[model samples]
Target: MKRIGVFICWCGSNIAGTVDIDKVAAAAGTMNGVVYVDQNKYTCSEIGQAMIKDAIKEYKLDRVVIAACSPRMHENTFRKTVESAGLNPYYLEIANIREQCSWVHKDKEAGTAKAISLIRTAVAKAAMNEALFAVEMPITRRALVIGGGIAGIQAALDIADTGFEVDLVEREPSLGGRMAQLDKTFPTLDCSACILTPKMVDVAQHEKIRLFTYAEVEKVEGYLGNFTVTIRHRARSVDLQKCTGCGECLAKCPAKVASEFEEGLVQRRAIYTPFPQAVPNKPAIDRAHCRFFTTGKCKVCQKVCPADAIDYEMEDRLLTNGYGAIVVATGFDTHKLNDYGEYAYGKHPDVLTSLEFERLLNASGPTGGKILRPSDGKAPKTVAFIQCVGSRDKAKGNSYCAKICCMYTAKHAILLSEKVPGSKAFVFYIDVRTAGKDYEEFYTRAYEECGASYIKGNVSKVFPEGEKLLVRGVDVLSGALVELLVDMVVLAVSVDARADAKELAKKLAVTVNEHKFFTEAHPKLRPVDTQTAGIFLAGVCQGPKDIPETVAQASAAAVKVAAIFSKQSLLSNPTVAEVEQKLCSGDMSCMAVCPYGAISEQVVEERRGREMVTRKIARVNVALCQGCGACTVACRPGAINLKGFTNQQILAEVDAICL
Candidate 1:
């Protein structure tokens, strides 16, 4: 018989005042195989630890049961103490008398009885305990950054500077992402490309960085420390090695499509570059718009190119690379403003999305840096920006803050004043949220120094008036109806998850919240960590974040990856349950019910060797078992039981406690 010792902690009246500790200890002492039952003021304290060690030595205890706080709090402490005393740490268990019993229960009798039952359960489990250990895996020192936006660029540069190899991937013809589409960044009023393109070039030239543009991450598989990624190189239809990014083919292509890079304000050729300052100096062709793809008749791009760069036969190539760690900086897409019919977004020529406005204000944009109204090609005298267009609305199904709208809208207001000189600008917002460092000051400066009007309400509707947009809304603060006829209306749309976010998450088997963002291990403590081991999330893909916060979080994820690389082997808790095959019957009931996939059926022969077909009971995969004990209750034949928490040990403890 296994000798078990029960230690009930008073926890300085945290438990004893509500639970009768003596009654619990006395009941435990009379149990079969329970050699000793003792009560302590604090079981987790050093003195209380010494009492436990002394009792173990005296009673020759094979298992220990500490009736005190939740195991989440003190299980590790007691386990370490047992390990230090040259005993198997997994042979210890804790009864959560403090939080689960005494603190929650008011009555003395009920609390005491609950404490006794808890102690009995722990004693029962401890008697069947077995030791466990963690398995470490080698980490690759390289990292893969999945976006070319500000956040991804910042992360790539930081990790490269740390003497690590980084693979930077982008789905566009150019390196700069949505941030490049912006004319100016908020609050500080820095030119978006002026501040960002330099880093884009840095990434292109960095020896430690491998930059991939017009390429997409087709698939990501394997765990952290060893991840395999397949990248699809879209047919650029141009020989990148031969063409010097000379403007020859772009000038000759006959087919023209609306340039999405310019927010559909201008037309681009069939073979075109994203912008004048595109990194890698390469051009991509629009396969759908190219006449050659439709009829196989046009060789205009090839005939015009001085350097033989156009390859009609070029096929998409898939390249696979192994990465040690991955930072998912996939970024976000702005909600299509056309959904809000009240805004008259697509119906009116004057109404534009915020991105279109950004293009209009850009020097390299369709209007050549002039903020012209689309209908009349005239400078706007007054412009209205609608904030939270599709954010913070349950009906729209986006209930969380988009986070960057308030600041960007304020910046748009400031820019409109600078662009038109004397033009009036209005920002309609449900709530002005500026929750970042120095962010509030920026919003305040826009109001006080920029001379923009900030209205506290949402815009109800918009109607066209020949060349202008008539905006109607109520100012909630003043309780007054407000109407404004503006030359242009900018919709500060919400940031939604990328279309492939859910699909990618499913492939990785990671959990995503309702917003379709990857769920973190914890909100505050483990922000960069995902529910899966070795994988980390960064930038707007996890949630909407500005440059500063995204960089900080990206750097944090890099640090975590670096730390994992520094370790020789990974360590994990070994206190997981195991099954005794000799006692197990061929019942498949527990196998079907286990949530962790820890239990599985295996073929085994009985002692009689009758060659009979048996159900072959479930066995726990120790490494994956989280030790939730769900399998123990699912066993109809009493075959499945947790190694450290068995039926015999518990029933003996209960019998002794009642006596």
Candidate 2:
């Protein structure tokens, strides 16, 4: 019998508050194979690990079970701890007493009983644990950054600066994301374009960084240190090499559509760039709205171009590349106001979401940097800014606070006051949160130095009376009803994960939160890393954050990618699925359900009677298999099994659990 050791963690009241650690440890000592039992205040800490190592050396424990947090949290930590004592890293099992046992059950007796059962099951499994070795794979050295947003731009720049080749992919025509649409950034009130455009230029000019604008990451395959990414480059009707970015094609084109860069405020030529400061400064023909594409008639752009750069036959091209690591900095989407009836976001021309308002403030916006009402194009004396439009509202909006709304609202108020002389800005909110440095001071400046009123309440109604908007709400502090007539209304819209965040997460094989934001491996310890190795997250794609925080997270993700590229080789997880050829009946059902194309059929030679014969069997590519155990479940003959979680070991755990 294998000599086993049991360690129970008090978890510093996290577990001990509801579970009796000493009683559990004593019961563990009486279990089969457990030769030594011990308890620790915090089993993952240095002293606690020292206690575990000392006991293992003293008792000569070959197998160990730890009653503590989830294995997802500290399995690797304890694996290292045991390996330091000359034991197989896989010769350990963790019974989740914190999240599963103590944290979920309040009754001490019931929790203690459940903890014992869990530990017993873990001990039984640990007895059957086997030594496993990792497969070393060479690193590709190049990194890939998804999205062309500020987060993606920053990450690409940082990674490229580290001397690693980086591919920055963006679906949009421009490099500047939402930041490029802004007039001025908050707190400091510096010009948004001034700060972001330089970075965009740097990314375009960097020799190590390859920019892919108007392109998307079509597919991501393989594991960490070796990912094959397929990118779809949307055709730019105007040839990039020949076009000199002159206005000839745009001026002669007889088709126009609502401009995305201007927040749909004005029409742009069919053959046009999103913005003047676009990184590539090249035009893409909007195929859907282009006159020549729709009617197959107009070739004015082709006839008028000095460089003859128009290519009506252009088609989307797909390019594939290998990357060592992938950084998902896809950014976010502004929450739609479909449910926000009270805000009247779409009903009135003067009312707009925060992003639309941001564009209105820009020098290139529809009003040309003028604080004019969208309905009449007349500058008005009063404007109302509503906060938390679709944020922190359980009934209709997102439950999480859109972290940037408050500061940006303040910024809007400041911009309004300066742009329109004597303009009064009224901001209504449920609560004010200014958590960043000098954020509170900046908020104070909006109300004190600028002519703005801060009301602590939710706006219940907005009525259009004549050319003005009447905003109605309650002042919670004074218990008084407040009504003000304003020229325009702006909703501080909530920030949400991209509509396709889940789809993207599926492609990367990463997990996402209930809100559809990408999930981090550990919120505190591994903020940038996803559960899937070599895949990292940055900016609002992970959660709501302001510019500074987004940039910071982007840099952090770059450092992580740089660290991976610095490695000579990466080791694949050893606990991958292995097929027992004897048990495999040549059924290939396992291949159909694999998200990663890791399983394939192979022909093996076997001696039947006096002659050799060849037969088919399912084989697993260890490097591509993520150890998800789907193959094991699908294997009808019970042939496919994951290391460290084989059928026999799982049965032992089940039997112990039943007892």
Cα displacement (Å) at residue 544, model 2: 1.2
For model 1, state the Cα shift of residue 562 in Å: 1.9
Candidate with maximal TM-score: 1
Location of the lowest summed lDDT over 10 successive residues in candidate 1: 569-578
**Cα error, candidate 1, residue 317 (Å):** 3.1
Model 1 misplaced regions, further than 4 Å: 5-30, 35-61, 65-74, 77-81, 84-87, 94-121, 239-243, 304-307, 477-479, 575-659
Each model's TM-score, in the order given? 0.82, 0.78
State the TM-score for model 1. 0.82
List lDDT for all candidates, in order. Answer: 0.82, 0.91
Looking at model 1, residue 6 earns an lDDT score of 88
Instruction: For residues 266-370, write the lDDT of model 2, one tens digit per residue.
Output: 889988889889888888889989988999899998999899899998899999999999999998889988998887778999898888888888987887888
Clashing pairs in 2: none
Model 1, 1-659: lDDT tens per residue?
88898888999999999999889888889765689888899888999999999988888888888999999998889988887776888788888999999999999999998888887767666766666555555567788888888778887888888888999889888888888898888768789889888989999999999998888888876666777889898888887888888888889999999997888889998888988888877788889999999778888989988899999889999999988877777788888665689999888878888888889889999998888988888989899999998899878637888889899888888888888898988999999999877889989988898888999999999998766889999999999999999888999888888878887776655667888887787898999987666677888889888878887888887787777667775554354556677767767677666644456678775656756554566677664465667777777667776655556756755764564
- Looking at model 1, residue 554 earns an lDDT score of 80
C-alpha RMSD by candidate, in order: 4.9, 7.3
lDDT of 1: 0.82
